[model samples]
Target: MILWGRPSSVNVQKVLWALSESAVPFDHHIVGGKYGGTDTATFKVMTPVPRVPVLQDGDLTLWESHAILRHLAGGVPPLADQWMEYTTSTLQPAFLQMFYELVRTAPADRTKDAEALKATFLAAVAPLEWQLRKTQWLGGDSFGMADIAAGAMMVRACDLCDPLSPQVARWYEQLQTRPAYRAVVMTSYEELRA
Candidate 1:
């Protein structure tokens, strides 16, 4: 299997974390963000959108990070899938807005967008605080794809935002202790930091 995407990408990191958790080994080729190979004809043929984290397993080529994670997990856990979707659909937009505004934008230019995104970011993460109060992991008792998806975003959120709700902070700390999360998702992204 060949995985194409930069390690620093949250979407790519989700796939890498899932692969590590599942004990699946594959060759990874940096192909997006600063690495910049997604525009090639071969890459275009493999994925119409030319997005990061394209997975090639024999004749099957898969795009979309969550779908790749689900495939790697063999069968989707219903609750895991729900949290995965929720991460992308609910949490990611606000997270991305704030992340880019604070980490990618110049500090002098950050306040307006950061202020605008703060309420939405807080609202989006509220569910995770509530959910973590009951379960050790988002998918329930064990770490799974849902954690991969939401955990990736949560790591970035915790890094760039203020104090997280108690349960959410505890949950994020637990995720950080995982070897896979540290290796794949929590590595320094110096180039991405403002």
Candidate 2:
């Protein structure tokens, strides 16, 4: 299997992190966003929407970060599967909205549009925070795909925003300890820095 996308992208990051956690071995091709070396003709055929994080496994081509995540989690635990859907369908939109505002708008404009977006994210994040307070991981106890989905976004938010909730901070710290999470993020960070 092969995955394509710039790792810095939250969507891309989610997929990469999940791949790292899975037992499967795959190649990661850095493309899209700033890397800018993707083959448009081939990419367009694979993904009609022209999004990042496209996965190719033999004859199967998959797009959308969340969908790719689900595909990767095929035989994983039930909680992992359930929370992956929940976070992708429910939590990620608000997070993405806030990210779009922050990255696309100027600081001055951030006050009006981005602040509203951020506030919406804060509201969205609260329930997850409450849920985490009760469970060690999003998928019950063990680290699984659901935790990868939520953790990918949670780590990105923590990077951009100051003073994340205590529960979130601890969770993020735990994620750092995971070799898979560290490998994906650090590899991406190093390549981006280069």
Candidate 3:
């Protein structure tokens, strides 16, 4: 199996974390972002939309991170589909907004309120935080696709949402102990800073 995308992308990080957790042997090729190549004829055939985290396995080529996660897991776990959808629709947008407002925007041009962005991200976190308070993992117990979907963002909240609530802090602690999380999700995102 081969995976293509730069690690700086949140979407790509999700797939990389999942693949690491599953212990799947796959080759990673850096493409997209500053690396370019997404517009190449080879990449066009692989990625219909010039996005990262594209996976090629056997004769099948899959784009979109969530679809890659589902395929890697063999099938969706309980509540995983729902949580993943919620993440993409809700949590992820807030995260992206926060990231862009803070990281991508130049300080001179950063007229957007940082507090408001954090609040938005926090509001999105409220529901997940409530659910997390009730269980060790998003999928109830064991770490699964659901955790991979949402958990990947927990580490990136250092500045935006530091000192996480009790349950989230504890859950993140567990994620930190995993070698895969450290190897993938915990890596520097400096490449994404603009």
- lDDT tens string, model 1, 8-126? 89899899888887777899999898789999998999899978999999999999998898888887778878888899898988888888888888887766656668778999989
Cα TM-score of candidate 2: 0.82
What is the per-residue lDDT of model 3 for residues 133-180, given as tens digits with 9 covering 90 to 100? 877788787788888888888777765666377777787888889898
How many clashes (backbone atoms < 3 Å, residues ≥3 apart in a chain or on different chains) does model 1 have? 0
**Which residue pairs collide in model 2, if any?**
none
What's the lDDT for all of these models? 0.85, 0.74, 0.85
Per-residue lDDT value at 142 in model 2: 69
Tell me how far the alpha carbon of residue 106 in candidate 3 is from the true structure, in angstroms, after superposition. 1.1
**Residue 111, candidate 1: C-alpha displacement in angstroms:** 7.2
Quickly count the clashes in candidate 3.
0
* Alpha-carbon TM-score of each model against the true structure: 0.93, 0.82, 0.95
lDDT score, candidate 2: 0.74
Predicted structure 1: lDDT: 0.85
Cα error, candidate 3, residue 33 (Å)? 0.5
Worst 10 residues of 2 by lDDT: 185-194
